[model samples]
Target: MKRKTHSVLRSRSGASITFALLLFLVCAVVGALVLTAGSAAAGRVSNLAQSDQRYYNVTSAAGLLADELSGKKVTIVRTREITTKTVTEYKVNLAGGAAVNANKIAETSSARYTTKLNERPEVPTELADYPTDTNDGAVFTDLTFLDTIAVKLLLDDANFNTDEAMNQSMKNGPEQKGVLRVLHAGSTDADPNVGVADPSSLSVDCLYVVQPDGTIILTLTNSTDKSGETYSLRIKLSPSINETESETTETLSSNRDSYTDSGFHETVTTRTTLTKTAEISWTVSGVEKVVSAADASAQPVETGTPIETDSP
Candidate 1:
């Protein structure tokens, strides 16, 4: 009887030990899963933050340019297209984290750039009178005041070449992936472009001039897969001019304001300036991406290829 009781006691003890082992194994697996999920969440957050930073970096630079142009003083006697030498020594500082520092000018030898300043009809409007003109019934006045500032910048040939390759790669193989951003957009509420839509569905064209008020245009663009259009922002070539002038900057500064000076009765009021946050965006790819040019250049023909037909 004593031996039988010992055998039963030993069986019960073995069962308890096996059950405890199973429970510990289950707890360990659950703990590992929790840690893994936490790590993945952290990684995703980090990536998103980085992406946001890159977008903001470009936008900030564009805004700075807009601010400068819109603030520039034009001759009150007769407004003319002012030429700014900012591009005289074009500079772009590529940050390690994909942030572009517009203020951080890069000194490059032998690279010459000529840029146009704000081109206005009449002189820029007074700051206090900006954004609106409450009362002005038609008197058939033939005066169109300059009320917006726009700035144009072209990606350098080297950068554009690499970007052109990427664009070609994506064009040939729609499977290829790329990024697009909206650098700056003008106010559409005042004067909207014919077909350009704001809060755009982001389909159709690679470049969308959101507003045609002469303010910043080409703010957003559809991805290659979506637009199926080769990027084109060249104003002139032999002179190496690509981006538009600073007309965009001045337009945005005076986006709203239409008053007859005659109505002012020569009050001699102080010029009111409107300060706005600069928004910048353009569909450009960079060589820093390091895509094999072969993917784009290896297409079939070479030599006699016309630049007008194909660029970089």
Candidate 2:
């Protein structure tokens, strides 16, 4: 009886050991599965974070490009040779103007970013169909009058004949009245007829000149220079020139009796504010930088012409 009881106890101990071993194997398998799932989720999150960062970096780069372009001044000479960079290279040049030898007046700025990283994912395109922004009155007017005024002054002061007047007009106006007259009076044609006024000019009726679209072209003779580029800026007069002109006419007549010719013409001089767009450009190494906007639209004025206006 004692031997049988001992045999039963040993058998029960062996069964308990087997059950414990099976439970440990199950736990190990579950732990491995949990670790694998956690690793996969972490990897996915990391990949998403990297993609977002790349997108922001690329967009910021584009903004930097536009800002630099707006702030720099560049003269387009000839189209330069193509260059290769680690990321991307910009070849700058001008169209719609006379092709001159490449002159490096000055660089607007250094490269915004320099990296041997991958090419920019977003390819940039040119911004098209923008007018030259300047303060010159010629922008609002047909500009023929601006050219002709110089010619007329040269003829009157310099005594230049028809042939000389035409040539002087085509070239920029001379700096001084004496020079114009001397050049004109010495010409072979002594008796020359004055040419007709250009009909293309818009009337400067009041403080502002109205363009075809009925938008007033407020001339800004002066503009702030940034990055060595002069921007042509035009703005609309406040209070609308049409309304202000009427008010001025009323104020002028208020002190006088009806139909009485006042001693002085009542003119309203309205103050105006000007907004400017800066012109900027740069080159990729030897690749020439071109200013297409400036070249096509900028009409050159004679550097030394004395502006004249006789007071009424």
For model 2, how does the per-residue alpha-carbon lDDT over 1-312 read when each residue is reduced to its tens digit?
A: 888988876765567768888999988999999999999999989766544433332233323332433323221111111111111122223453443342222211111111010121211111121122111111112323222232232233232222232223212333321101001122244454653222112111111232222222222211112222221222221111111111111111112112222122222222121111111122211111112435312222222323221110
lDDT to native, each model = 0.28, 0.26
Q: How does residue 252 of candidate 1 score in lDDT?
A: 16
**Position 91, candidate 1: lDDT:** 28
Cα-based lDDT at residue 192, candidate 2:
43
Question: Best by lDDT, which number?
Answer: 1
- Across 89-127, the per-residue lDDT of candidate 1 in tens digits comes to 212333344442223122211111121223423212111
Please state the error at residue 25 of candidate 1 in Å. Answer: 2.5
Model 1 error, position 172 (Å) = 39
| Candidate 2: Cα lDDT at 300 | 29
* Per-model TM-score versus the true fold: 0.25, 0.20
